[model samples]
Target: MKNWAVISTWSMSYDGLLKASSMLQNGESAGDAVENLIKKVESYPLYKSVGYGGLPNEDGVVQMDAAFMNGDTLAQGSVAAIENVKHAVSVARKLSLNKTNSFLVGEGATKFAMQNGFEMTNMLTERAKTIWQNKVKEQFKTGLHPYDGHDTVGAVTLDQAESMSAATSTSGLFMKKDGRIGDSPLSGSGFYADSHIGAATATGLGEDIMKGCLSYEIVRRMAKGQSPQDACDTALYPFCEDLKQRYGQVGEISLIALNRKGEWGVATNVEFPFCVANEKQKAQILMANPGKNQKTQIEPISQSWLDDYQKQINAPVE
Candidate 1:
């Protein structure tokens, strides 16, 4: 079995996964490795769904949600509807060390980050503002439901010491209501970890993701002797089907898991791209989609896909 592993939702996390892999290979703590990995994504301006350039709310404000979990202790820290913080994941990581009031929101969360010396910046960029403005105009003119495909960067890491950590960060859905928050900052919904068992995280419609507490379910199954892959497929596929039956519809849902042995698994109801690395493998991007019989089809991401994505994210907003 591999000695360490790191897996994260979305192809956008490829670079971060590489860095985190290097940290894990060098014997760094899983918590530090995962946090720094997310920090890389949070600082990238081209990723419109995460920290620096994340899309804004309906009122033109960039509100972010983030969470961090220490598998060794089950300690979790979270922030929601926070604004202006350069790395919302960092704020959440700091809160993980607290015993009370670890979950903070709105102005209170922002204040805690400020008081704790976190970097402060205008999280909304000109490009993001332009896109949000155009989206608003389009929705107003078209009178259609707002296009809502937001991707969160959720990661699970296992270190050489067998310690595990999970974290999630996102600016939330574009044109979201003011003070609105999603599953990213909510433990069990967005992320969960346990050193003795495994770690898992989810990305997609947080509202639906929370309805089933998908992440926690995956880890719970792993603790009961399920492989990471089995846990992810069994936990996610059944929930997706049940949600569709009960709720009449389901949103895009994707999940990633890594067990203490450095094995990994993924399941998704959409064409999801993710990044992963382990002691026996270099960091690489892969694609996952729901397949026949409720299994997930996994394959290497194509260069053509990467090229197109790069162009799309970097394209100028009209």
Candidate 2:
């Protein structure tokens, strides 16, 4: 009667190491696999928004970061402000598994990428550059830029019975320094998962991500008998309250969770908000994105659904 599922911080990644692993309900052979898939996806260029998609800068060049973790081992791999190199997560994974240190940043991570044979490139887009140029001309003191919700991606998964892993990748805030880094690649802060309390992941608004350790907080809440919606809602409630007190700026958080007994739930700050692909259910799997306006309808998983999911958790995907 155990449960397992994957929750990505953002929905845009198609080649996330953990995303690929979750789709197959496959347990990785080693910790390195988490980054391997992330790197492999970087070659396509289109997925750049997730793994290689440079975060749009005020001036419109790409800056990126990534991180990977194995819940079973609590081992961490991280890289910040790395440029051009795809599969940033893989580079970090190698560092964590092969080195004494748990993190690598900026030029250091890029060097590790080269040492490991990861090729570098100029990860810029014509459209994004044009937008930045336009912002510069608007005569505004603060140039405008777009949020690459598409560029940022994170992954969390609890495979079969009890294996959990999380991976995250992103282009940093647009118009940032040539070497700016965001929370996406920060362990525990951006995206984190632990096998002990099911799994959790987050996306959107990184600087404030540290405010409450959002994803992990939801996991702990779910562990304490809160439904997925309850856990996610509770997490967001405080975030909203704190914003009023701190900077008067409201923020959003997204989450998906699976409990130990084969039930699942999702919460977000928008509508038509998220998607899910399960071992048994793969077609048209989008779920509601939590919204600030309404109470998320909480439904109990029928015994049959729970039983079926339990089987899915333990059985290898076809």
Best by TM-score: 1
Alpha-carbon runs more than 4 Å astray in model 2: 1-4, 9-11, 14-48, 138-151, 259-262, 283-287, 291-294, 297-318
**Which 10 successive residues of model 1 have the least lDDT summed?**
141-150
* lDDT against true structure, model 1: 0.93
Query: Tens digits of per-residue lDDT for model 2 on 1-318?
Result: 233444443323334434554544554332333344455455444443554434355556666777777777777778887766756777766766855766777777777788879867677755445555665666376554445443356655556656666677777665666766767777666766666665556666677666768777877787788986777778776666777698877555555665543345666564423434445544123445444454454332345654654464244312
Identify the leading candidate in terms of lDDT.
1
> What is the overall TM-score of model 1 with all chains considered together?
0.98
Per-residue error (Å), model 1, residue 78 = 0.2
Where is the poorest 10-residue window by lDDT in model 2?
9-18
Q: For residues 1-318, write the lDDT of model 1, one tens digit per residue.
A: 339999999999988999999999999999999999999999999898999999999999999999999999999999999999999999999999999999999999999999999999999899998998899888889997564747999999999889999999999998899998989899898999999999999999999999999999999999899998889899988898898899999888999999999999999999999999998888899999999898899999999999999999989887
